[model samples]
Target: MTEYWRVKVDPRMCVRTGLCAASAPQEFQLDERTGQGRATAEVLSASEEVLEVAESCPIEAISITDAESGKAVFPPDD
Candidate 1:
């Protein structure tokens, strides 16, 4: 079975950078009005590309969690 993850982009932390959308167009997009990165969907199929996009966020505005467990997947817990 394919794993799924919950994705989120913190608007407060986002600097209107298009990195997430550029890196993972299918999973992220910049809201035209807000000009902030947003997840295409709250939950998406797990993939390395998505994780890389989250990691590539300069401000670390993007976060991912295991949809089933609600465990942090990126920006790993300290």
Candidate 2:
């Protein structure tokens, strides 16, 4: 059985800092018209690069979560 994860960016919260795209070029990119960073696709595996992107989001717009559990991974549970 394979597990998956997904990346979410809140459009309302995003300020287009470009950190997400810069940090995870393989996973995120800027929208052509909006110039805001967005997930290129749903991530199927965990990667430290993705976590760094989420953490670097100045507005905390990026989030990564278990596809099934819907629990946050990066930024963790404090």
Candidate 3:
């Protein structure tokens, strides 16, 4: 099975815009204290559409990671 990750926003890049959460409400949430976005999900479950949320990040702060491989699928440079 394709494992999912509890995505984390890069602090340096995150701007507290809350766009990721808006894009994928089920998978992500904003931390008002830190003004950062975090994954509210456990396993992405393939049917998940969080990738759209990650892409919506203006700074690309959101990352879609493959838990088993420990490799990132988005923010290609990372």
- lDDT (CA) for every model shown? 0.91, 0.80, 0.72
Name the weakest run of 10 consecutive residues (lDDT summed) in model 3: 41-50
- Estimate TM-scores for all models: 0.94, 0.83, 0.75
* Candidate 1: Cα lDDT at 60: 96
Per-model clash counts, in order, read 0, 0, 0
* By TM-score: ranked, best first: 1, 2, 3
Candidate 3 — which pairs collide? none
Q: What value of lDDT does candidate 3 attain over all alpha carbons?
A: 0.72
Q: Report the C-alpha lDDT of model 3 over 1-78, residue by residue, as the tens digit.
A: 355654667878888888877777787788878968777765564435777777778888877667677677776553
As for TM-score, the candidate ahead, 1 or 3, is: 1
Report the C-alpha lDDT of model 2 over 6-48, residue by residue, as the tens digit.
8888888899888888877888999999989899987646777
| Candidate closer to the true structure by lDDT (higher is better), 1 or 2 | 1
Q: List the residue pairs that clash in candidate 1.
A: none
lDDT of 1 at 12: 89
Q: Cα-based RMSD of the predictions, in order? A: 1.5, 2.3, 2.5
Off by over 4 Å in 1: none
